[model samples]
Target: MTSDSMLREVHVRDAIGLVLAHDLTQILPGTFKGRLFKKGHIIREQDMERLLDIGKEHIYILSLEDGYIHEDEAAIRMAEALRGENLSLTETHEGKVSLISDIHGLVKVNREFVDAANAIEQVVVSTLLNNSVVQSKGAVVGTRVIPLVVKEQTVCQIEQLALQLKQQAEREAGPITVKPFLPMKVGLITTGSEVYNGRITDKFGPIVMDKITAFGSTVIEQRLAPDDRDQIVAEIQYFAELGVDMILLTGGMSVDPDDRTPGAIKQAGADIVSYGTPMLPGSMLLMAYLPVGDRRVPVLGLPGCVMHDPYTSFDVLLPRICAGETIERSDITAMGYGGLYRC
Candidate 1:
């Protein structure tokens, strides 16, 4: 709490040449709502009527003693302490600073560090969910303090916590980092006899191509294979021989007798990570890794829902894979939470 002796209150008419101690917000129903006077703004003789119209009959001027810090300064310090690679900070505004991404990539948030920092009195740090996808210049985190001014020790405690976490992680970067996506060469195989026999036009090609290109990767080659496991396995090996970074097998992911994509993937010498995910609209998704000449290429058996659904397990895992993250069984199992999607 701020002591009364630290603030001098005077009528707006008599406050000319004095600095504003805090931001003054003006609300006009639905028309306008924002800071009409920012902290540190010098009072002008011409501004008296406007301030009065906003119901500001008096204003406070702060006289800070030692060991105290203004909210804007505190927020700036917090942002500096939490900023990591591929992130930029916005200028402090209304005692808040935003962390922006410098590239399109995966957002990795250190929840433990964030929680520890927020435990300090008057300190606030809000971030996007862990493993979220972010585009360039998108705001991922915001930092601020609750009061107009706070004890310098509060800010110091937050900084110290951040430093300790970074040291324990053996990295100089802060809690939030954006890992840039790598440009990969992907091979796509569309299974099912109907599409291979030309009984129906192939629909998975365009959709899969769009998803691949969106992540800065290209489908170098695409092949259509029937329900024969041997032919599907041959195509997988061919792509691996080409040294593509990833192989995508679409269609035939279910457990029906004719759906041979899962067995075909395993037959191609792939180490299956997870045969199915717990996520809705994509529960039959399969994840695997194919070793080729000291490199482990990612293999994904995408379900049919990926064709029309706006988001699915494929959406959740694709970004992480493009960011060079290895998908594990635990990662697939964790998708059960917040994975249900309805049309």
Candidate 2:
């Protein structure tokens, strides 16, 4: 369907000098299914045979009027207004502009700002959910004006509102940013006497390694320390001295009397970031940072949830950390809204 505007009918032979009102779709089973000629394309002699081959005897084109903005121009201008750091834009075409991620990283979107912009007349920008982990070159947002033609005044209002939203978001964070992942040299420590003594197979170790490896990092060194606070502290110290980027204290983080991993992190002289989270299946998560020379190494105390649960708070936070994000207590607290992992 065409955008909100009057259309002018033109015969295929008389289509030159007119703008296509809608996309001309071409469908061929198992081979092609896309636009033969995009909307807003100006007709030319070369397009006549192609248009006829696509079964177009006549076509509808936008009847341009003064004081009205064309869809292509509107989309480009709107994209400029909505563009933020770590975002790239493709050339506007067919009245659409795609916002792409410039790096493999976490996507941070200011939803409030996006909503405000969408509320403007004829302005439409769709994006991935906030805090989504995205790959580089992936399309994060698709923007276009709703109508084929809109009043120039409407366009001006959209740009102004977008500017206000951008400014307000800049005061806080921004409308969007791709936080790139860092190459982490992880020191893995498996806690629990059962796992360490080989009575129970070390399921957490392989799981932690898999998670770390997915983010382009590998376990530099791994230690199985029975839930002795002193022994855990010693393992942590050894990894620190080896200059690992982060430490993973897996298993034995529950309220059981045998769980001593949390205290051991404290004894190892790491600043605790948070001892718990609101997320289910992983609420017992613990996070800390230890100083090794001039650098601070993050030490994560994963709950028992990582052993069996396919997803949990650890999944949400680990990628951000790998992306060089310094997660805080408030970050964990704010996760309660979507913290139900079981569903």
Best by TM-score: 1
What lDDT score goes with residue 307 in model 2? 81
Q: Where's the lowest-lDDT run of ten residues in candidate 1?
A: 1-10
The alpha-carbon root-mean-square deviation between model 1 and the true structure, to one decimal in Å, is: 2.7
lDDT of 2 at 48: 94
- Deviation (Å) of 90 in candidate 2: 4.1
lDDT of each: 0.92, 0.84
Model 1 residue pairs with clashes: none
Residue-wise C-alpha lDDT for candidate 2, range 1-343, written one tens digit per residue: 3334568778999988888887899988899999888877899999999988889989998877777878888877776666777888898777799889888788877787788778876788899988788888998888887777877776687677766775765653246667777889999998888888989888778888999988888899789999799999999999998989989998778888988999999999999989998889789999888988888898899988888999898999889889888888889889898799774
